[model samples]
Target: MLEKVRYEGAYPTREKADEAVRLVLSGLGRQLTGDERVDLAARLPWEAARGLTAQIPDTRQLTGWAFVKDLAARTNASLATTRWDTGSVFAAVAAHAGPDLLTRILHQLPTGYALLFGRAELTQAA
Candidate 1:
């Protein structure tokens, strides 16, 4: 999942990024159901996102402008400059599968550093 999800912006340190992950995990744990828990657990090692550093390529060496540009292209979303202090990236995976499909995919996403916003069809990945 981490490999498929493109990351954007300057996370000063891994700890900063991990802080976001921690917040997301706490929120998501409260949103789970019995079936969802079972399905997630069966997927493999439970804390997949925690292993993100190992699985995903590093972007730290890239220039800030280059990093954001690459991520924006990969995710098919523009990086917002006005709201730069907030969430730097604004991404949306369109409905090749429609709203229901996206909802399921999103429900599986870790919530801490990542935020879900906007309408069903045009969901924003911040």
Candidate 2:
């Protein structure tokens, strides 16, 4: 998983990739709840799962944009950098999640998460 993140993110070292992974997953652990959270945690490898499950769930859900912004503030990184980091981590996560679980995850999350996971989010016309 770290190898995937390191290569995908083009990070200087495994340590850097590990840091990015932890930060983003910890933020997500705080945000996600219920079945989505538990399911995703079970799907991820142990370390990633721990990073994702360690946080006490946030009672209020944030929009995808708000999630990115909140993560940036928590990490003291610029929004652009934080967004990049989030995508890097989530892209790897999406790969582990597979299509079925990924679809379910996107359904639970607010808009913009699909793109973060490196998937296009298409909506049905009413």
Best by lDDT: 2
The deviation in Å at residue 22 for candidate 2 is 0.7
Error of 1 at 19 (Å): 1.2
Report the lDDT of model 2 for residue 55: 96
| Model 2 ranges with Cα > 4 A deviation | none
Scanning candidate 1 in windows of ten residues, the lowest lDDT window is 88-97
Per-residue lDDT of candidate 1, residues 1-126 (tens digit): 222122443556655444434333333333433454344334423453232212333323333344344444544545563123123222212212245543554564433222432333334679
What would the TM-scores of all predictions be?
0.36, 0.93
Our model 2 lands, by Cα RMSD against the true structure, at 1.2
Q: Which pairs of residues clash in candidate 2, taking residues 3 or more apart in a chain or in different chains?
A: none
User: Candidate 2's residue-wise lDDT over 1-126, tens digit each?
Assistant: 889988989999999999999999998898888888898899899999999999998888787788899999987899998888889999899888889988988888888888888888778899
